[model samples]
Target: MLYVPFAILVAALLFGVPIAFSLTLAGAFGLWITLGDVGQVVEVVGTTVFSSVADYTLSTVPLFILMAFLASQSGVARELFAALSSWTSNIRGGLAVATVGATGMFGALSGASTAAAAVMSQVAVPNMRSHGYADEVAAGAVAVGATTAILIPPSIALVIYGLMTETSLGDLLIAGILPGVLLAVLLAATILIWVRINPTLAPETYPSSWSERVASLRGVWPSATLILLMLSLLYSGIATPTEVGAIGAVSAMALGFALRRLTWQGVMIAVHQTLRASAMIFLIFIAAKIFGYYLSLSQIPQMLVTWVGHLAVNRWFIIVGIIAGYFVLSMFMDELPLMVITLPLTFPIIVSLGFDPVWFGVLTMMMIAMGLVFPPVGMVAFVVSASGGVALSKVYKGTLFLILSIFAATALLMVFPEIALYLPALVRGREF
Candidate 1:
C-alpha cells in the first residue's frame, strides 16, 4: 500500500512536477488511501508544515545562505584563490593544487557546493587553462572539490539532515571536520599524482618568492577569521547554529563594507539570492513534513526498520547498501528533496542498528557530497561546465577520478568511524 504513494511520488517527479508539489500530492493521496478523508490529510499537512518550518533551529538555513552570498559578492573567493595560488603556483600542477585548497577553504565559508563550484570555475578554471592544464582536470577539480561545502560546518545539507532526524546540529557540524579535511588532502594528492603521470596536464608554473608568500596572507584573514569564529562558537557550545550563522552573516557584511566590496547593488543581489535559496529549502521542508506525516501513519517506516533489524545479513553490508543507494538515487534527483523524502525511511533503520546518529550524519553528509559529483544529475559538474564555458562531456570525464577519490574517502569513513566521531566527541567530552 505504501508503494502506491511512493510510485505516485516518483511518477510526479518524472513528469516534471516540482518536488514540493510532488511530495504534497503524493502524501495527500497516501493519507487519503490510508485515512479515507481529504480534510484529515489537509489537517496533518497544514499543522506539521507550519510547526516544522517555524522551528528556530531551522532558521540557520537562510542566515547561512545570506552569509555565503554576501561573502561571495564581497570577493572572498577571488582573494582566497589568489592568496593560495601565490603560495603554490611554482611547482608542477601547483595552481591546480591551489584550486583544490581554495575551493575547500571557500566551501567552508559558503557551505553550498553549487555556489562554490561556480565561483571556483570562474576563479580557478581559467587560470589553470592559461597555465596549460587540461579542461577535464581543471573543471573536474572544481566540481569534485566543491563538494567539501556539503560536509563542512554550516552546510545546508547537514542542516536539513539535522532538522529532519532530530539530531544535535552542533555535533553533526563538528563531526564533518576530519572527513572534510581528509577528502581535501585526497583530492590534492590526486592532482599531484595525475599531473606527475601526465605532465602535459599542467605545463606552465608560477613559483613565488618567500616575501610574496608573506604578502599573500593579507588576502586570507577574512575567511580565516570567519572559519575560526564559526567553529569556536559551535564547538564550544557558546552559540547555536543559528546564532553562529547570524554572526557570520553580520561579519560578512561588515567585511564587505570594510573591504569596499559590497556595493548597495551587491547587498541587494545577495539578499535576493538568499531569499530565493531559502524559499526553495523551506518549501521542501514543508513538503517533507507532509510526506513524513503520511509515512508515519502508514506504519511502513517502522516495519521497514524492523525488517532490516531481522535481516540475517551482515550489519556493515546494510551500511554500504544505504550509502550505495544514495549514490544511485543521486544520479536521477536533486539531493535536498531526495534526502528529505527518504530520511524518514532510512533514519529509523539506521538507529535501530545501533549506529551513532552523529557518525551516521557524517557518513550521510559524505554521501550527499558524493552526489554533487555523480554523473547525469551532478549539479556541481553542470555549474562548473557552464561557468567555465567548457564542454559538459569533458567536465564529466574529469569528475571520474575525483569521484573515485570521494569513494576512497567514503571507504575510510566506513572503516574508521572514529574519524568523524573523534572531534565531536572530544569537543563534547563524551565517549563514542
Candidate 2:
C-alpha cells in the first residue's frame, strides 16, 4: 500500500479537515508504516516541527505579512486607488483599469491574494458601481487584479516555494517583478477591450482635471515610496529578504502613522492579524516538512522521477501535462496547500527534466494566479463577491473572461523565460 498515505490525505481533505492536521496525520501514519516503529514517528515529528520554521530566511514570511496587514488597516488602498484612477480616468472603463493598477501597486505591500481581493472589493468596487460600471466588470477586475499579489516582490507564495526547492529567495522574489507587471498590463488591456466591445458595461467615464490629477499624486507618495524602497534594497543587494521584510513592515507602520491614518488601535489589530497569519503559515510549514519526510521514506518522488525520465515524448509535452494537473488541482485547492502538497511530487520531476527551478516557480505562480480567479472554487472570486456585494455567478463570469489575460501572460512567459529571469539574473551577476 504505497498509496495508502495519499488515500488518507485525500480523505482527510474531503472531510473538511484543516490542511495542517491532514498533512501531519497522513505523514505520521506514513512514517509509522514505512519505519514500522511508533517511537521513530514521534521522534521524526518532533525534529521536523522545530527545524521547519527555524530558518532565519523564513523570518521574512511573518514580516512581509505584517507589512501587508498594516498597509491594509492604514487606509492605503483608498488613497492608492484614487491616485491611480485620477490618471486613468479619461479612458473607457478606466476605473476598472485603475483597479487593476491599484491592486498591483498594493501587491508590492501585501503578498496575500485574498487580502488584496478583500481590500480592493471594498475600495474599488463601490466606486466603480457608483460610476455606472456593471457588477461583473467591477467584481472581475478586483478578483483578477488581486492575483498579482502572489507574484510581486515579498510574495509569501514565492518565499515558500524558495524554501521548498532550496532556490535563492532573493531571486524568486525578484523573478516575479517583470512577470507581475506584465500580468497587470495584460489585465488592464483586457478590461479596456471588454469595455470597448460592450460600451454599456461602463456607460460613463470620469475625466479628471490636470490640477486634480497633479494633486492626486500627492496622496500616493507613501505607497510609491515603500515600493521603491523594497525594489531598491532588493535590486542593490543591500539587504536580504528578511531584512527587506523587516524594513518594509516598519516603513508601512511609520508611513501609516505619519499620514495620520494609523492609530494605536490599528497597530494592535495589525499585530494581532500578523500573529495569527504567521502561526497558520508556520504550522503548515512544519506539517509539510513532516509530510515530505514521509514521501522521502516512501521514495515516491524518486520513483516518479525515474518513471518520467523513461518517457520518450518531448519534454514540453511533459511540462504541459504537469501544468494541466496543476490547473485541475488548483481549481479546488488554495494556492499554499496546492503548492505544499504537489511540490514534493512535481519538483523532483521538474528538476529531472533539467528545468530551471526559479523559472518553474514563476510558472507555478502563474498557475496559482489562474486558480485564484478560475471557477468552481476560486478563493479570490469568493472574497470579491462577498466583500463587493456582487452575485457569485457574476463574479465567476467576470473571472472566467479575465482568466484569458492570465493565459496570454503565461504564453508570453513560456516564449521568453527572460521575462521572469532578467531581473533575477541581475541580482547576483549570474546568467540564467
| Predicted model with the maximum TM-score | 2
Where does model 2 exceed 4 Å of error?
none
lDDT per residue, candidate 2, 86-193, as tens digits? 999898999999999999989888998999899889999999999999999999999999999999997899999999889999899999999999999999999999
lDDT of 2: 0.92
Per-candidate Cα lDDT values, in order, are: 0.88, 0.92
Tell me, by lDDT, which candidate is best.
2
Off by over 4 Å in 1: none
C-alpha TM-score for every candidate: 0.98, 0.99
Tens digit of lDDT per residue, candidate 1, span 1-432?
767999999999889999999998988899988898889877887787779788899899999999999999989888898899998888888888888889988988898888899899999999888888999889988999899888888788888889999998898999898899999999888888888899988888888989989899988998899889999999899998999999999999998899788888999999999999999999988888888888998999999988998899988899889988887777666679768877999999899888888888888877877777778778888889999998999999888876877888989998899999998889889885
Q: After superposition, how far is residue 399 of candidate 1 from its true place, in Å?
A: 1.0
Model 2 steric clash pairs = none
Give the Cα-based TM-score of candidate 1 against the true structure: 0.98
